[model samples]
Target: MTTFTVPPVLEARAPAEARGVARDGVRLMVSRGTAVSHHRFTDLPGLLDPGDLLVVNNSATLPAAIETIDGVRVHVSTEQPDGTWLVEPRDFDAARPGLRLRVPSGSLTLLRPFTSRLWVAAADVPGGRVEYLTRHGRPIRYSYTDRDWPISTYQNAYATVPGSAEMPSAGRPLTGAVLSALAGRGVLVAPLTLHTGVASAEVDEPPYPEWFRVPSSTASLIGHVRRSGGRVIAVGTTVVRALETGTPEGWTDVVIGPDHPIRYVDGLLTGLHEPRASHLKMLTAVAGEEALRASYESALRERYLWHEFGDVHLLLR
Candidate 1:
């Protein structure tokens, strides 16, 4: 393992609107060894050498937002494969206690206090249609914008497998032309799945459990990249999780930070996280504290936006 250093804080001072479409259109900051440069998202293909491998997370985002019986808004941000939910209600009335939600196929009652923002519920999805109904319920959206959330807005063109309560986000900037351009340049592309749960608000509770998978093919490809001395560029933190978790003997407890050592990925492309977000800790683990802090401070000074629909940062080693 490499010796890690703590970096300075990167502030996000950019307005939300500036960072919005930039999700697919933001600037990309790339670092190779000690070299750094700035470029548009369209320039991704030019940054990679022929043997570099781009690892993408194909987990689909779930429409986890739903309305309760009393019209109280509740966001089911994380869904367990076992049919339970990790819920966060907007201004939940403790006196009212339980919440009843409607899904496209059936309804579910959320039992309170599983944790601060977690709830227990039971629902039957014949042939596993939970994802389908969640989509039908409503498009999962962030509270930052007032626009009616569109499913297409939350998805990257390459997204597959419906499971995340929120967008994986890291790949949001990967447009079709960018992908084709990479292919034309001989950069290898691969996929994995790390269904992200609902993003806990900066003021919401801690992270809830989410499901993920690293296909045998993906694992093999990563190994091949490492053996050939080719960089494994993970598209987002979710991809980092999937790759790190897939390591021969590694496990995470949902906490982010420098204490964790990522074993599989060599480079990262991700969004600008809010100050104090647990996600920042994950970035620290991958980029080391010093580089992360420097990048963050630069982003803040550059006024990068924070959240899912925001600008991105790339760190390569």
Candidate 2:
């Protein structure tokens, strides 16, 4: 009963990289346990107190999808403990081991299947993976995304470490200006690295184990702020997972839901998740079933948009 219907038109058609909207001009929906409110993304600084800390994911988005020699496009999802990668190949006719898939600048060999659509592959980038992908790859986009956008648009302003197959989109609205304003207001902002894997935004299954790192510095800051009675807000679910798991650095497949209570994070800043998506379960853990249902109803009634380039939701409980 907590999940509500979302209109198709509510889906985000494209990121600003493919179009001409101010990248950070999206709307924001703010919610407490009992009621919901609406505001522009610019008002984020005013919503918090001086001691509040906003944690964001610094994992940069990758131009992970590439067209191979045989007209098959592969989306590199995750880098495994070994040098090989987990990839999703589209329109691939012959999917078998030792198939040398060539990119514009390099090549890859499909080793075997990791999952249904995902394959384990060995990459051969002459100029290095990052450089080659920068030249030949495009950001992995879903069907709802009408056209291709530059990989730059998929990255957060604070992005540094290049790893994520997709964007940690919840932090997209936290523009440098917004961050600067928060700093001026004495609200602390911290960073964690949670390299997200490829997801279609509608995935119902639990997320795969993605690499994440919560450095000692970030952990210490979080502890200090919490001990001082300050609110610790995670800017995205990725950050929430990284913090709750509390690993110095490791892979996490932790799936949080209503049955699983989240600790450490006080509130959340996230994109409007679709109903039945696994992300909604994470939101349910934060806002509870009844409150989340009401929030969804309010969002649909107000015509708030969804997806990476659309509006955001601020959950304060």
Candidate 3:
């Protein structure tokens, strides 16, 4: 694996304002090997040939942000099969072992506190399930935004099935018009589900876990794309994890990196990740370390924004 140098400038995070929408809306950076290019997201259709396949994670973002009466904020991270929630709360005082949370219509009784942030709560949804509680009263918004944006704003125009706690972000730039344009150009689009858990903070916290699946149809379609000499362009890192994790043999705990060989995706369209984010490791798995570093440096010099709701980078082999 080639080791590319990370630019010092790229080490510092960009201001939130710089990460907001561009005039044309989507900001795009394209990379091929070590060379880099730039364009607006609207120029996507022109970037690919007719036969390229775009694979998107259709997992929808849920309204997982909630606020407690005491102003303690919690973000629901994951939902258990039994319906209990894995949560991360902020400014939690140990005194409150349990709390009553108000939702859209009803209230939830938090049973036990798992950690300083995590808790087990029960709620009455359409089905009887222990709902994971978070401080989010609405959808998880980016730090840059002041008010809570509607959950719809956090979703890609093609998003289906509400499951993810947050948007798969890399796919955010693909609006409805772009999807239609891609379809019109004969680029086949496919979907998979990978419910994202939580954003990876720049700390020692465990890597957020997620549940994902690639159906037989999606697997076959991916095989067909490869057989037809069409590039499989993953829309986001979430899609990358879904496709990579759901290889036919079975699911894997594989943390992607340079040592791992990509079995499915031929190209990647993703947002600029933070320094040391595990997603960057996944990119290295696909593009090699040297190329990945070069692309990141280019992105920094070119002022590509980082984090969700930031700029996007497309790497094509």
Against the true structure, whose TM-score is highest? Answer: 2
Please provide, for model 1 over 206-232, each residue's C-alpha lDDT reduced to its tens digit, 9 standing for 90 to 100. Answer: 555556777788788888888998999
Query: What would the TM-scores of all predictions be?
Result: 0.83, 0.93, 0.81
Residue 114 error, candidate 3, Å: 7.5
Please give the lDDT score for candidate 3. Answer: 0.71
Superposing every Cα of model 1 onto the true structure, what RMSD results?
Answer: 4.9
Higher TM-score: candidate 1 or 3? 1
RMSD of each candidate relative to the true structure: 4.9, 2.0, 4.5
- Candidate 3 local lDDT, 187-280, one digit each (tens): 9999888777767532323345567778788789888889999999999887877777756433334566677788888999988776656777
Ranking by lDDT: 2, 3, 1
Between candidates 2 and 3, the lDDT winner? 2
